[model samples]
Target: MFLRIFNRCASTATASRPTSFTFPQRLNRSPTAILESLNSCVQTDGGNPAYIFMDDPFLIPTSGHEKRQLALSKAS
Candidate 1:
């Protein structure tokens, strides 16, 4: 349901563009706009813990060992 609505909105937004932008140009310009749109959507839904953590990194584990493990896994 959310994906359907998101797809519709994305298609509508892309269809209305008047410029002949390439795919790469569109991709580069999309992140900020997409983030703003997602933020608004999630805000309305009262945001889940996962999304909340993504925006505020400090909410993640603070223990030195845990941080080191996470960093090591991410590096690989």
Candidate 2:
């Protein structure tokens, strides 16, 4: 169920652009934590293949520091 929705949303995403998707529940985790989890999920050896196949990475910034970091990363 979750995968279907996520796949549909992810399919429309492009690697060269920034897109946003909102989940049902608010996330309580930190941006770094979320990124780490996603990073692990995309790994080839021990990861969710569904995420590995995503065209672009997901970025969820939940704090000012994370927002700034994301902006800087994109700028460079």
Candidate 3:
């Protein structure tokens, strides 16, 4: 799920030249941390995928493709 999100975001950044928002120097400073967060969210919600938007909107919104990818991942 996370890999898919990263790929989508990277692809979007490559395809669109628009300078709308500057991405962070790194998406998540630590992949382990993000994974941990996802796991915690899952545990809290009975294995549901984490939508870490309300907590950190800026971190998650730009990659619409990511959300879609995650949905697809969930569906599969």
Candidate 4:
């Protein structure tokens, strides 16, 4: 059902000449590995474990409620 709607909308937006897209190789392209490579970029303030999270346990967010609250607070 969603695909039909998407195709209808996309058909109108598409050009007369259809273009082909070739995706990049994905052998070792794991999402976790990609994020792990970014660990060195995180700023460490005084080498504190909770420094990045402002020392708030709620900010660590193990549940949906905590996650939403943290997201809303940051958005404000």
Give all TM-scores, in the order shown: 0.25, 0.24, 0.23, 0.30
Would you give me the overall lDDT of model 1?
A: 0.65
Clashing pairs in 3: none
Q: What is the C-alpha lDDT of each candidate?
A: 0.65, 0.65, 0.68, 0.69
Across residues 1-76, which tens digit of lDDT does each residue of candidate 1 receive? 9999999999999999888665654355564888888787874445333332353476464566766666666669
Residue 13 shift from truth in candidate 4, angstroms: 6.2
Mind giving the per-residue lDDT tens digits that candidate 4 earns over 11-60? 88885656987888858667687677788677657644333345576558
lDDT of candidate 4 vs native? 0.69
Better of 2 and 3 by lDDT: 3
1-76 per-residue lDDT for model 3 (tens digits): 9999999999999988875987668564675897888787864554433564434555454466877765676679
TM-score of 1: 0.25
Q: Which regions of candidate 3 deviate over 4 angstroms? A: 1-21, 44-76
Q: What is the C-alpha RMSD of each candidate to the true structure, in Å?
A: 15.9, 23.6, 24.0, 14.9
- Runs of candidate 4 with Cα error greater than 4 angstroms are 1-18, 29-32, 47-76
Clashing pairs in 1: none
Candidate 2 on 19-69: residue-level lDDT in tens? 777779876887699789888888476533333234345655546776677
* TM-score, candidate number 3: 0.23
